[model samples]
Target: MPTEYHDLSNWDIGFAALLIIVNGVISVALKLGLEKKLIVASIRTITQLSLLGFILEWIFQQNNWFYLFLIILFMTLTAGYTSSKNATRFYSGMWINSIFAVMVSSWLVTSIALLTVIRPETWKENPAQFVIPLLGMILGNTLNGISLGINYLNESLINNRGRVEMLLTLGATRWEAARDSVQSAVKSGMIPILNTMSVVGLVSLPGMMTGQILAGVPPLSAVKYQIVIMFLIASGTALGTIIAVVLGYRKLFNSDHQFLYERIQKR
Candidate 1:
């Protein structure tokens, strides 16, 4: 195991400013036009993470399942809302489904992992710490997958409407007609997790592992935790994407089994 890691001091962060200066200089030299956004993003990152750190500390101190669950709900809703913004541009009535899908899938996967695979003594005992962070991570990735996959599905449906209609007219079911689009969209959502898994430990040290090792955990223990986190993310992303895409595909068609092309257009 590694020795206790050195904690960052106020002075330590000054070094990070140099990286920001370098980035800003490059942006100016190349006219990348990202300086303002970069600065704003940096500020937001610091503010949000600092706030979250305090909030998590409070929740940890409380040691109450209710507070933990409430935080989880907030995380789920926030993630759902963020992803919904991406999807709402292409379809109506999607935000609600996105929220529902994310809330359900994230909670389900988080619960399963907490209850079975990574079971703690009880919610109040030893698992709340594990539950919140793991759930947040799963929800974040799931949100990305659902948003990207839904966009892909929407675009696929629009681009291949004629082919879909031909299949529909040839006695194909709605599911059959939209099969390719669904598959493509689902694949799009799942690819990130898959790629990450493929390259984990080889190409990169995952955030969880890096954080754990930096916190002085044994490498093998951190690896085990990272493995659990990765699998949980994959499961949550898959379930969320499948639910969102299936629900989203249904919205692309009407009650009469006809493709509602206009639904794919901005409302």
Candidate 2:
């Protein structure tokens, strides 16, 4: 069994980065015009991840709950705004609603996991180690789910405006009129995670498990951690998608059984 993990040096990292040239070469050969975008993306990845590494290292060293809370809040808010931008449609205060939905879902799942499943010794005193990574994973997946959900909801409402109005005119309640769209939107958001869960270990090794294995953790232990992460992601995605879709539904309808289709504007 491998007991010690290899520590990558700067030279090793530079060598690995050279792999991006393969992509640049392909783009140039095919006249795809993606070389510039690839270069920009590579630079951004290096800069953002390097800064995040330093910030996280400092936060871990301090072990202060206030700093941790502030970091988590910032991450959640950023995720909310990012998710809102995925929608091609716009409504007033959509960003605020996205933020609230993501914040609530990610925080709830992370808190549950910390308190129950992976209660590290210094969890209460210094949760930075566990909380940061776990919340980040959940938040990332939840952002995708929320984005997909909102986009689908908006598009569905716009495309089926006539059907929705017909149902409303037929004396159906708002919920009844929008039920199909709401269900479809929620399902669309969940489909990615559901597909991932279905073929996780069989089809591909997930990032957390692969990282742990590379760091010399026992395979079984890494698998357990990966399992926990998958469950947390699933829960967070479901909650975020449901909340976002429900909120959007309410926004596009009124208690008087009227469809407020005018509020949804295509961007």
Candidate 1's TM-score reads: 0.92
- Please give the distance, in angstroms, between residue 33's alpha carbon in candidate 1 and its true position after superposition: 4.4
Against the true structure, candidate 2 reaches a TM-score of 0.96
Clash pairs, model 2 backbone = none
Clashes of each: 0, 0
Candidate 1's C-alpha runs over 4 A off are: 28-33
After the best TM-score superposition of candidate 2, give how far the Cα of residue 106 lies from its true spot, in angstroms.
0.3
Q: How many backbone clashes does candidate 1 have?
A: 0
Cα lDDT tens digits, model 1, 53-124, are 898889888888789878888888889877768663478778888888898899999888887877666554
Whole-model Cα lDDT of every candidate shown, in order = 0.87, 0.93
Q: Write the per-residue lDDT of candidate 2 for residues 111-139, one digit (tens) a residue.
A: 99998898766476768989999999999
